[model samples]
Target: MSRHRRQRGGPTFARAATLLQITKLVEFPAVFLSSIVQANVLPSRQYGQLVVDLSIAFIAATVMSLGVEESLQRALAANPRDRAIWTEALASRAFVGLALTLLAGILLVCDQTSLAIVGCIVVANSIYDLVVAQTASLLRPAVPSIFNIAAVIAASSATLLVRPSSSISCLTITLIFSSLRTAGCVLLSCRLLKPVRLSFRDAVRMPNLADRGWRPLVDLTVYRLTNNILNRQGDLIIAGIVAVDKTSVGTYALAFSLTTAANTVFLTGIGSMTLTRFSATYAESGKFELGKSWQRMTYLTAFLSSWPLAILIAIGPGLSVILFHGKYPGLALYLVLIGVVAWLGRISGGGANIAVLFTLRNEKLVRKVFLMAAAMNVATDFVLMPLIGMYGAIVGTMIGTFFSSRFLNVQIRRRTRSSVEWSPLLLLSCLTAIVTAPVALLHRSFTLSICAVVVSLCLWATFSWRSSICPPEISSRVHDVFGKKSSVGTD
Candidate 1:
């Protein structure tokens, strides 16, 4: 009887993990379509600042999150022996939320407007990340949909009240809704988890930050930090490095906003599931060999995420010209580049699970790699921004991401039995480039020969590669997730 119960519940656990991954793919359109609606409806200045704000806010949250939420989430899945660890992480994260607010307030008091604004973003970010971390780890993936639906509703409501021709109020509406979305998720968490009442003392007592758990915490922070500078810092730097002209910056923001939002769906959605699954696997087996299953999933995601970006890079400018009536053609290029870059970025993210899995054993070594990556990112940004303009920001991203992928990232991943499926990315990129060239030349045509070819190939590649793509566990897990199930993902 006990064995039967375990068998039934086992699928549930597996399905929950898969839901976390699918949520990203399933939710992609929601984010992209919503951004388009908001882009068409919001004032340019507000929209630019909003992009910059969200960008900076994420970075701030990284600093402020202090790895507490991640700690809790992993403990929830992989380490139930210390139940108090979950409570402590939650408490520490909450306390940090307060601290982030205070930190933001100080910058505001000093009249550091950018920093102050960054502070607000951080506070919002901290709340959102914690809410997401908790829900993704503790509840079923559908609960996350409740939060997404709430965000969609809030964003749509804001759009209805705002218009492209309206004033900056549109931007404010968008930001408000984003912040409120975090609050709504928290409400759902309360209802679902009925999380035990925890106090500051209990949270603080748990050895969360610098203890054995600190390894994952440190690796995540530095890795997140490096990515932030490469990706997030681009917007703010645009305002300074090349965005000295208000209208120009605003135009770029319009395009960049769409790409970032869409990419976030994939990054945020799948990233959590990957982290949680790998972390749990690590806890159970202490084997990096298990991550090989994820390597298979990586191939599928790389193929799936790429050509759309290639197509966008091909068609986005024309679409922009028609959509916004040429509100900003330059932005179209930014969007395409960002999409391609994000797809490239995600191709590597599946590998990060190794870092988390190995973190406990290689904590100090992992920290050094991330710190090194961060330093390179900052140095490159400082040196390159003056040279290539906003595009240079992406150069930093490419460089940093490349460095991480080739150097530190690979080393850590080597600890696991899994090897990076580097061929697909190169193959996809080359094929995409070949296909896109003709489309670019045919700028005047409504239909792109290059885009058509790319899309057809993308579909083929995605489907053709599915069986060849996932590792045994990942394939089994994915099937488990999408198939009929009664119990596991019900949470």
Candidate 2:
């Protein structure tokens, strides 16, 4: 029998992408509200502490999860009914959680209460993520996605209503909501699938390195660790550790959170779907079809992301003042810097890192690329942060992103012997940058900034529409949405 099932012809790329985008659209508001509430209500020092605490929690969670989540997903995808792998994975995660809980207790005894709270978050988030991985593997992601949305809404509502005085209180409320969501997910999963039983004996033992999944598990774990450190919370963590004042950390965290939110909303949706799509395409067809799909999706990602990037550049300073209720001196510069780097990184060589892992199945290569990037990022941050503060962290990240993207593109091309078609994406990016340039001058006047943003978007849209810069698949979908027949033809 084949190790993997034959293609059952899942959702079309366009349909899958559209559904993912819709899902993010529904989720983004709650997430945005949560961020806004936290930023606006908390004092800068408290907010900085909160950011640091959460970053530490996330990093710890990533470490404890042991990258077995991806291994479990791959195993379950091949055989969804495999109870043995499922149980083993859960036991492994449980074992790590238990160990971490003990560490938390130790910290509590040492009077590091904030870190103790983070330790609790680490356990909760790790297990929750494992459950989510299982859901995705079983092709029932909506189960956990719904629960996640509800959890965010509940937590954010409580925060806004209660207006907690301390970061600890806010984090406690968040943990409560998160734990509830985890319980809900477990119950719902048990109902939908088989009940997951964790064996105490299994939980106490270390994983067998002799197992077939060991190599991939290690690779993925390192990849995720490096990626998280470099991209997700590394800046905040470094700033929290190295900055002279909590206010600077808070400012950087706020800017980081906003840009990350925008990224999650616009770019992440498509990237999330690419792994499955690329895997299936390579399985059923060949590298040729996979390359085509990659190009198409890359173009679409660039097109969708450009709008948010432009908007951020145009009105970022004004939006910062309005949302935070104060002038953040470098907030506008942070937005522009982070936004541009993020956009460029995603489109660089058509997001080759993701394609390499999911399509080429080269975990080692992915791990190496990210590790190199992380090292570069850390080195730069350490060198510059003491001299220039938060700006150093951002600049470090920018340099690392550029290097990693370029390195991945070159390595993937050499391995796959395929090239990304970048003409349309390049044109779109150039046009977006050109039109949004004037907004930098107008940023001081909120009214003028807004007006400039509107004008810039309109001009870009008109030009892109007329120039046919969008991928045919996306353009056709857009036309269909507007009840217009597509004039663009696919190859």
Residue pairs with backbone atoms closer than 3 Å in model 2 (clashes): none
Clash list (residue pairs), candidate 1: 12-488, 140-491
Question: What are the runs in model 2 whose C-alpha is more than 4 Å off?
Answer: 1-13, 33-59, 72-113, 116-146, 195-213, 349-352, 443-473, 482-491
Q: Model 2, residue 473: what's the lDDT?
A: 64
TM-score of 2: 0.79
User: Model 1 scores what on Cα lDDT?
Assistant: 0.54
lDDT of every predicted structure (CA atoms): 0.54, 0.63
Worst 10 residues of 1 by lDDT: 482-491
Residues 301-372, model 2: lDDT tens digits? 766777778878887867767766664567878788888878878777535456545456677887888899
Instruction: Count the clashes in each prediction.
Output: 2, 0
Single out the weakest 10-residue window by summed lDDT for candidate 2: 1-10
What is the Å distance of residue 132 in model 1 from its true position? 4.1
